[model samples]
Target: DTFTEDQICQVQEIHVGKPRIVATIVPKGSPFKKMMIYG
Candidate 1:
């Protein structure tokens, strides 16, 4: 997926402050997507 420059920059900035902000995918199709935070 292509993200805008600003969006990418924002994500980078967020990573600088908190380097663990990524989504965790679970097995099978579900309605809930888990978000794992590890700083």
Candidate 2:
């Protein structure tokens, strides 16, 4: 639930030219979908 909110805020910040950075946290060796990710 909170993760979704964080992504939304990160995206909005990026759109507004904010210096905040957003990074994804995944388990080591985990495989992610071959698409753009906001989380």
Candidate 3:
């Protein structure tokens, strides 16, 4: 899904001291779907 750049609220490292990412985000409109994400 394509989301407007303005829709982006925030982007940052999930862990403060770690450099590994196990999950990523897939933007969504619905609150429920929005909760789900993948890289």
**True lDDT of residue 17, candidate 3:** 86
> CA lDDT, every prediction?
0.56, 0.57, 0.58
Clashing pairs in 3: 24-38, 24-39
Each candidate: how many clashes?
0, 0, 2
- How well does candidate 1 score on lDDT at residue 19? 60
Give the TM-score ranking, best first: 2, 1, 3
* Clashing residue pairs, backbone N/CA/C < 3 A, model 1: none
Identify the runs in model 1 with alpha carbons over 4 angstroms from their true place: 13-39
Cα lDDT over the full model 1: 0.56
On residues 1-39, what C-alpha lDDT tens digit does candidate 1 reach at each position?
Answer: 899998877774343464666666666554443332322
lDDT digits (tens) for residues 1-39 of candidate 3: 976776655644355685777765545576656456431
Question: Which candidate number maximizes lDDT?
Answer: 3
TM-scores for the candidates:
0.28, 0.32, 0.20
Query: Model 3 Cα RMSD, Å?
Result: 16.7
The Cα error of candidate 2 at residue 11, in Å, is: 22
